[model samples]
Target: MKIAICCRKGSFSDYWLTYCEENGISYKKVDAYQSDIMKQIEDCDAFMWHFSHLDYKDKVFAKQLLYSIEASGKPVFPNFKTVWHFDDKLGQKYLFESIKAPLVTSYAFYTKQEALLWANKASFPKVFKLRGGAGSTNVKLVDTRKEAVSLISRAFSRGFSAYDPLASLKDRWRDYRSGKCPFFVLLKSFFRLFIVSSAIKLLPLEKGYVYFQDFIPNNDTDTRIVVIGDKIIGERRGVRNGDFRASGSHILLPDASKVDMRCVQLAYNVSQKLGLQIGVFDFVHDKDNPLLVEVSYGTDPDYTECEGYWNEKLQFTSAPINLPKMIIESFIQNSSN
Candidate 1:
């Protein structure tokens, strides 16, 4: 079958193209941004595009485009089931609850009055997050009622920007101090303080709602398990120094021994129930039970590297594998059926 792939330089498309070339798979490169994208891929049996939440253009129409294409009965790597809640935490909250999945206790309120009422009654140290944002970008710990009220006010008033330049700079500086990044990278982040990103500028402010997750305490690290088709890979990410957020801390423990297979099995079962082709689930413990913190369909390809992967039966297989190749093969198999 002929396949159409939208190539983004550093995205999964690069590996996908390499796999196509090596395997002699019939494929055509098409740009998803083009107005005639559908016509371009009309002859192909499947389409694949690695759209990013941080991209201005993709945020506008990627999901709509993918939904339309899939509705037409042609296959896509990330279909509607896989990505309807891709970058939306609010959507995921409702979805997890509906499915009775082991999600952390969360609350969302659209009205200022409702949010204020809840804040007044809720316990301290709730985790506040903007519906959108990855890598702990818009996440904050609300330790007092006053802080929660202030956040509610901002959510109903001027609103929060999708990008926080000051926070970004601080994170970059921390990384540089820890020798995780170079000085040049830190310098660039400093300059970015004055100049806002075009993507963030084009996006409207996040307002009109507040989301909070009940803080589960005493966890120094969180587990990230990624399920691609039948394979599961996992790692533990340590929280930043003096911080509770671990998603972007970059302090990773790649030892498979540290990964809890129970989390892997939970992710696998949830993915199956959701009919997802790809899922990356982050888990924080509620005492002994693994409660899901968040879910996403995309992650950095570099982070997928592990000593091995687990099968559906929770059996570990020590082998080097290409994730992008696995994704394409799964798509092909699905399309053929």
Candidate 2:
């Protein structure tokens, strides 16, 4: 069987190509952006593309392409089950509610009046977020009714940009101060503030709706568990200093001892129930019970160093697992079957 991979530098494609070559697997590179992309992949039995949420081009047509191929009986790495809700917090809320998953309580309002009414009655200190954005980029803390009202007004008015330059600069500065990133990276962020990213320019503004989640206080860290096939790996991410967001904080603890097995079991069960080949679940605790904050099919592969992985039975095994390889192998196996 042959596979067609949409190659992108710095994405999972790099590892997938290496794995294919080393394993003597039949594969070819195809540009998902090409007008005749479907025709280009006609010779392959399966397709894989690590399409990213941050890419405007991918956001425009990646799902369309993948779902079309899937409907044609060609297995894809991230099938619809795994990616329909990706980078869409609003969609995730509905999906989790439908599936009865242990998701954090969230609210979404499409009208300004509705959002204002809810804000006035709802408790303060809620977590505000855009429908799309990863790594806490479009997230904020609404500490007062006034703040919520202001946000609501803006949501219905000028709306929020898909990319926040000031927030990006602040995040880069935080990383530089924390020694997580180089000074040059921080410098680039400053310049970014003056320039609009192509992705942001191409994407539409986020407006006409407001989303908020109940704040679960006293949590200094959150868990991120990635379920790829039967292998589960996780790490704890500490919230940034003076900030409530843990994702993209770059503080990762890969100790298996620190990982809660219940989260592993929950992620595994959730993946199984959703028929997902791969899922990255972010969990925060309310008391001792873990609630899913969000789910995605992609993450920074270099963000953590895992000691090992947990099997389907929640059994920890010391082994080095290549996530990209697992994704490709799963697609190949499914195609063969």
Candidate 3:
């Protein structure tokens, strides 16, 4: 059977194409943004698109398009359940609660009055977040009720932008200092202060609702577990220098022995229950207990650096991980069935 893939450069589609060509799998490249995207995939047995939340166009209709394709009884890489909550933290709050997962305590309020009332009584040092954004964008630590109230007021007023130039610059500087990126990359970030992209300009302001999660303190690093079918790969990311967040901190501590199996198991269990084709879970620790910060269906596809991967039984094997291959293999197998 043939497969339809939306081939964006540097996306998971890159690996998918490589794997397909190397293994002699029949596939065609189609632009999901086109008006006749559905018709283009009509002959394919399955469709795959690594839609980005940061892109205004993808944000507008990726989920709807994927959901529509899956509804037609054809297997897609990320079906309805996997993608509906892809980048939505508000939806994730309810989803984790409904499934009784070990999600960090989260709160979402639709009204300024309700948010203010809760902020007044809620403890300090809560983590404020917008509904969207990856790599720690739109995330903040509200250390006091006043700070929470200010954020709440702003959320209901002009709202928060999908892009923050200052914060982006700060992050780029950190990466530069840590040698994770080149000077040119850092320079580009500095230039961003004056020139915002048209995509960011097209994005609607995030407003009317404010979300917060109880801050889990004393954790210097966080773990990310990514499950592709029954195979799991993970890594530990150190928090930014003198900062509380870790997701975007390019600090990679590549020690498979340090990988927490509990977090791995939790990621697998949740993914299996939801029938997700792929799942990426970020976790922080509260003492000995691992608490989930958030989850997504799409993340960086490269897992070659991971020393090994764990099986569904939590058995670790020292082998390189190829997440894109696993995803395509699983997709083809299921579609064939």
Candidate 4:
């Protein structure tokens, strides 16, 4: 039973490779980007690829390819249910609402007139976000109706770039101030202002639709939970100073005592119900009740601060959390079952 693995640098692939090597798991490295990708995986019993939202190529075809492979009766790491909504907030709004999950109140408008009408009546300080983007790339806070209307106008007109140089520069400066990045790294962010990436150039502008979520105030941090099979690990990330977003803040508080078990349980249940091999959910509180913000099948695999994992019964175990290993194991077990 050989597993087909696509190894992308900085993705879960490196850890997957290491785990397979150390445990003597049968595996072969295949490139998903190649034209002969399907043929390369034909001999393998299973396929795994850490397809990313940031990659324009992956955004275009990774889900299509994975779904096709799964339909052929071979197991894949993230099957259809897991990745269909990977980088799509618009999709998540529908999915979470359909499941009756406690998702933050969200609204999406397809046409300029519809969006303007909603914006005029909606409450201020809503969180605006594009359908695709991680680390708060295309996210903004619409503090007033005027701002919302302007955003709606832009969304239906010229649209928005997938990459925002000014916002990115601010993020870089924050990192520099927090000592998370070197001064040289901060300097490189300036280059992005003048030079757009080829991949970003290929990505079409996000337009036509405008999505907003009801802003839950007074929360300085958000909890991020990662669930694979029955094991759960999480961290509370502080929001950037003077900012409302927390996902990419890099300020981690890994104390298990601080984690709300309810969110953990909800995460596990949602993942199980969705038949996800691996799920990463971000949550914020709406007056003490945890409301899911968004979810993804793949995330930055680094969880060095994770003290351990919690079981389905909310039982915590003091063991190192290796997400890639657990994900592959879960995939194999589910496939066999």
* Cα RMSD (angstroms) for every candidate in the order listed: 1.1, 1.1, 1.0, 1.0
Q: Compared to the true structure, candidate 4 yields what TM-score?
A: 0.98
**Distance from true location, Cα of 235 in model 4, Å:** 1.6
Give the poorly placed runs of model 1, Cα more than 4 Å off. Answer: none
lDDT of 4: 0.90
TM-scores for every predicted model = 0.98, 0.98, 0.98, 0.98
lDDT of each: 0.90, 0.89, 0.90, 0.90
Where does candidate 4 have its weakest 10-residue lDDT segment?
321-330
lDDT tens digits by residue: candidate 4, 54-87: 8889878999999999999999978999999998
| Residue 268's lDDT in candidate 3 | 97
lDDT of 4 at 84: 94
TM-score computed on alpha carbons, candidate 2: 0.98
TM-score of candidate 3 relative to the true fold: 0.98
Native-to-model Cα distance after best TM-score fit, residue 166 in candidate 2, in Å:
0.3
Tens digits of per-residue lDDT for model 2 on 32-114?
Answer: 99999989999998899999988888888999899999999988878999898899999999999998999999999999989
RMSD of 2: 1.1
Give lDDT tens digits, candidate 3, residues 1-337: 8889999888889999998999999999999989999899999988999888999999899988988998897788788878899889999999999999999999999999999999989988999999999999999888999999999999999999999999989888888888888999899999999998888899989999999999999999999998887788898999977789998887777688998889999999999998888889999999999999999988877767889888899998899778778888887887788
